[model samples]
Target: MEEERGPIECRVRVPATTTNFGPGFDAFGAALRLYNWTTLRVGNGGSAESLPPMVQEAAEAFGKAVGEPIPSFECAISGEVPCARGLGSSATVRVGVLVGLNELRGRPLSRGRLVALASALEGHPDNVAAAVLGGFTISTDDGQTRVALGSQLEFVAFIPDMEMETEWARSVVAQTVSLQDAVWNLQRASRIAAAICLRRYEELSGLFEDRWHEPARVKRIAAWEEMRRTAYGAGAIGFYLSGAGSTLMALAVGRGGEVATALTRVAAKRGLKGICRRIQAENRGAKAWLRRPSRRLA
Candidate 1:
């Protein structure tokens, strides 16, 4: 008789991503050191019906992509990325489950293929591209381009005690823009991508100006103007909405501490309770590994 196969457990660590840096709306994203760890245990008699909707979707997609039926599995998620905060938290979960399932299936898909699947699930490529490839990613329909960010660069994120749903945020944005505004945003977005790729940090200044999305969304945020002014005054190179925002991010070279402090203080004065964190770019992206099954006493 053939021996029975034991249960397999796969764990994945997916980095948090900040997308839509300035005018690169839905096109730009970078991975941060903050992460969410997800574990998938297969052959444990776990039912797919018990899984969250997002996880189930990911698993179903993975099965379809690989041309195999995915076994029922149990999933556990733990991490620091907060949901509905424009921090790519949902992307982390989707990517984590996909990667975890792939690992358990003998890695039938390539990383690029996984990225494509993830982008589809995310409804955009920016966050999923960054989460999969790490560093800084510029995602266009043509493909994705990545650039390594130096450790000196700091991302100071001010996460308010509020949640802004991505769906609602997208609903507020206008579908039309003036010719001048379109040109302006295109120029800045292109320059910002080049600056990061060429390591021209100085050129990044003034290039984060956006004529789309932020204008409509900022109105919902309390003391938005003051937050931007304070961040700049405290040594931020560029400050902008992280994604669809309740959390704002500021780029600083070495002045992250000052910027974080200023933003925190200003938020408090505005009666907005929140936390500030200084994080660096995570170049390693998401990683998955199979856990060795434990043996029981005979």
Candidate 2:
């Protein structure tokens, strides 16, 4: 039998993700350098209060799945991952909670089980898979996921002054798509995988266009056309809506600063207010570690 230990403390950090990447739709996602942090510890005489709703729910689900009497936990969260900007902020929170709890329970759950649990909680796996597995991920409807690493490209995200709820953005997407558009996106999605593998960054510009969700969703963003044009003019080779987006992201190598400045300047001129930041893809996903309490048996 395993010996008892001191109070367990777990800290988890999960990266933000931008899903779809123009044409992959609900299948593709990339982890970003931006992150959300959550710390969890076993506690006494208190409810799981003050935690994010997703975190609280995840804790309950995990406890039930493990069939263990779960101890009350205190959770604290802090990060720059903005909510409702299509950045997978909720995924970070959910993934962090699951990971932290798993560690506190001595990590009986496998990574695959964790992925499945997180995906189930998310109702979709793209963002959760990327947050859990890191790098770039493609999730299939058959409950399978493929991941690839190595993206040297930098990203410039132009955040808008307002927020767009994911439900509303999802509701706006078309229910039907033509076969031609489906084939078009499928070919490019395949090519994108190859391009990222071969480090063929120049081939991405053409691949970034989509005939499906982007067309329907673009109408919601004011000055979308102009923003796309300006992003390219500012030396971004490829640009796309970040997830469901109140944020637009441009892909570049050495031109992130230039692209970010141009995006902000153009948005300001168009009376849209928000900040722009240059960030890179994070290959490492969420990490959780146990910090044991100092030994003092007084």
**Per-prediction TM-score, please?**
0.96, 0.91
Give Cα distance to truth, residue 105, candidate 1, Å: 1.2
Q: Can you write out model 2's per-residue Cα lDDT over 203-294, one digit (the tens) per residue?
A: 88768898888887778788888999999998898889888887898998778788888888889899888889888888888998777644
The reply for model 2, stretches above 4 Å from the true place, is 1-6, 142-151, 293-298
lDDT of 1: 0.90
Per-candidate local distance difference test: 0.90, 0.82
Kindly list the per-residue Cα lDDT of model 1 for residues 76-120, writing each as its tens digit.
Answer: 999999999989999999999999988887889988888899999
Number of clashes in model 2?
0
Candidate 1 segments whose C-alpha is farther than 4 A from its true place: 1-3, 295-298
Which run of 10 residues does model 2 get worst, by summed lDDT? 1-10
Show the colliding residue pairs in model 1.
Answer: none
**What TM-score does candidate 1 get on C-alpha atoms?**
0.96
